[model samples]
Target: MDFSDLNEALASESYDQIGEICDNLMLQAASEGVPFQDEWPYAVHLLGHIYVNDINSARFLWKKIPSGLKSSQPEISAAWKICQKLWTKDYGGVHESLREFDWSSQSQGIIIAFSERYRKRMFELLVSAYSTISIRDATVFLGMNEDDAINYAAVGGWTVEPNSGMLTVKKAAVAVEQKVDPGKLQRLTEYVFHLEH
Candidate 1:
C-alpha cells in the first residue's frame, strides 16, 4: 500500500487518472481475495468520478460499494447525495450537499475543485442560453451571494440593471469554420482518379 501513485495523481489534480488508479487497486485487491486495509480511498475514487462530471460512472461506483462501508463512512454517503442531486439537475441541492459535508483532507481538494468547475460550467450555460435573468436565479445557480453573483456577472461582461435587479447576459458568438486537410484532399483526388480509370 505505497499509495505513491495515488498521491501523485492527487497532487497533479488529474481526477480521471485518480479514478483509474482506484479502479485498478480495487480490481487487484479483489483478484487477490483481500479487502482494502484503508477503505477511505474509495470515497476519493467516487469523488473523482463526480469531479469529472461522470455521473454514470459515479452511479456504478456507488452501486458497487459494499453496504457496510456505505453505512459506516459518512463521506461516501455525502458524495452519493451530491451524485443524486446532480443526476436530478438540482443545482441548488448539489451546492448544499457539497457545503454540508465535513470532508476529510483527502476529499476536500476535489470537492472544492468540483464546486468551482460546476459553477463555471453553469455560468457558461447561462451566458449561452439566456438574454436576461434575475439576480436571485444567478445566485442559486452559482451558489454565491447577490453581491458575489453580480460581481461574477460583471466580470463575464454582463450588465446589471440596479433598479430592476436583473442581469443582462451577453450571449457568446458561435464560431463555425470549415477547413479541409491537404492530405485528405489529395487522397480524395487519388480515389476519384482510380474510380474514373
Candidate 2:
C-alpha cells in the first residue's frame, strides 16, 4: 500500500514523473540487493508509460517483467493488453481493453485520464487529417457509439450530415510566428562573412 514516490506523483496527476520515479526505485532496489519481483507495483509502472503514450517504453517494461510475475499478476497482464492494442493502432481495442479489465483503485485514475487524453488526441488528428469522415470510422477512432460520436463531433464544431452521416471536420487555424534569436543571427552572419572573405 505504501507506494512512496508513485503515490505522490499520482496525487499530483504528474504522469510524466511516474516513469522516472519507477526507474529510480527499480535501480535502488537492485543496488540494495533486494528482489523486487512482484513486490513492486509493476502494473502501475507499466500503466504510467502507457498513460504518456510511450509505447516503446511500455513494451520494454513488459519484456523486462519476469514471466512468473507476468502470469501471476492479472493487473500487469491487463495493463499489457492496453499496450498491445496501442502498439497495433487498434483504437477500438484500446477502449475495449480498458473497459474489460477491472483495474484496482490505485490505477483507475490514470486509466481514466489516459482515456480522455487519447480521445482528445484522436480528435486533433481527425481535425488535421480529414476534411470529412464517415460516422462509422469516427466512432471507431473515438471508441464511441454512433450517436456519441456524432454529438462529440458536433461539440467540436464539426457539422454532421444527417443523410450522408459524414462529419465535416473544423480545423482550427494555428498562427506560428517565427522567432529569430539576434545573437544566433549575428553569429551566423559573422560565419557567412568569414566564409565569403
Candidate 3:
C-alpha cells in the first residue's frame, strides 16, 4: 500500500476510495501468497471494513490475523477493540475513543474510519427503537438539525406526515432464512457473524 496516498485519502475522508485501494491491495497480497507477518495490511483491511460498516467482514479479517501480529501492534489491538466495542454495544466507549483518536496518536485513519460505522449504528438504533418517531425526536437521536433531519427522512424514503415532523420506519426487509457457516470455530466467536451471504 502507498502510505502517502493512503494517508492523504484518510485525511480527505475519501472512504470509498480507501476501500478500493485496500481491496486491491488485499487481492494482490492474496495472489502473491502473502502471509500475515505484520499488522499494517490487516489494519488497512480493517479500515476498509469500517468504511462500509461491514462488521462481519471485519471480524473475518481479524480472525485471519495471526495472533502474534494482533498482540504485537498497538494500533492493531486498538482497532480490534473498537470493533469489539461496537459488536458488544459499548457505544459510549467507542465514541469516547473515537473522539480522542487522532493523527497525533499515529492512527487518525483508523479513528476516522469508525465515524461512518458509528453513524450507521445511530441510524440502526433509530429504526429499531420505534416503528415511528417524530422528526424532531429523530433529529435529537441522530444529532441532525431540523432541515437535515427532514432531508434525511426524505432520502431514506420514510413516510413523513404532512405538516407533522413525524417519520415512519416501514418494516425493513430481511432474509427469509439465515445461512449456516461451515467453520465451527468461527461460528462460535461472539464477534463473528455465522450466516453466509
lDDT of each: 0.87, 0.89, 0.66
Candidate 1 lDDT for residue 56: 94
Q: In candidate 1, what are the lDDT values of residues 123-175, reduced to their tens digit?
A: 99899779999999999999889999999999999999999989999887789
Model 1 segments beyond 4 Å from truth?
A: 37-40, 176-197
> Residue 118, candidate 1: how far off, in angstroms?
0.6
Give the distance in Å from residue 115's predicted Cα in candidate 2 to where it truly belongs: 0.2
Quote model 1's TM-score.
0.85
Order of candidate numbers by lDDT, starting with the best: 2, 1, 3
Steric overlap count per candidate:
0, 0, 1
Q: Pick the candidate with the highest TM-score.
A: 2
Error of 3 at 143 (Å): 11
Q: Which stretches of candidate 2 lie over 4 Å from their true place?
A: 176-197
Q: By summed lDDT, which 10 consecutive residues of candidate 3 come out lowest?
A: 97-106
> How many backbone collisions does model 1 have?
0
**Tens digits of per-residue lDDT for model 3 on 101-185?**
4433335655555565565567788777778888877775555577887677667667887676678876567769867776865
Candidate No. with top lDDT: 2
Any runs in candidate 3 off by more than 4 Å, and if so which?
Answer: 1-8, 34-36, 99-106, 116-124, 127-197
Q: What is the C-alpha RMSD of each candidate to the true structure, in Å?
A: 6.5, 7.0, 15.7
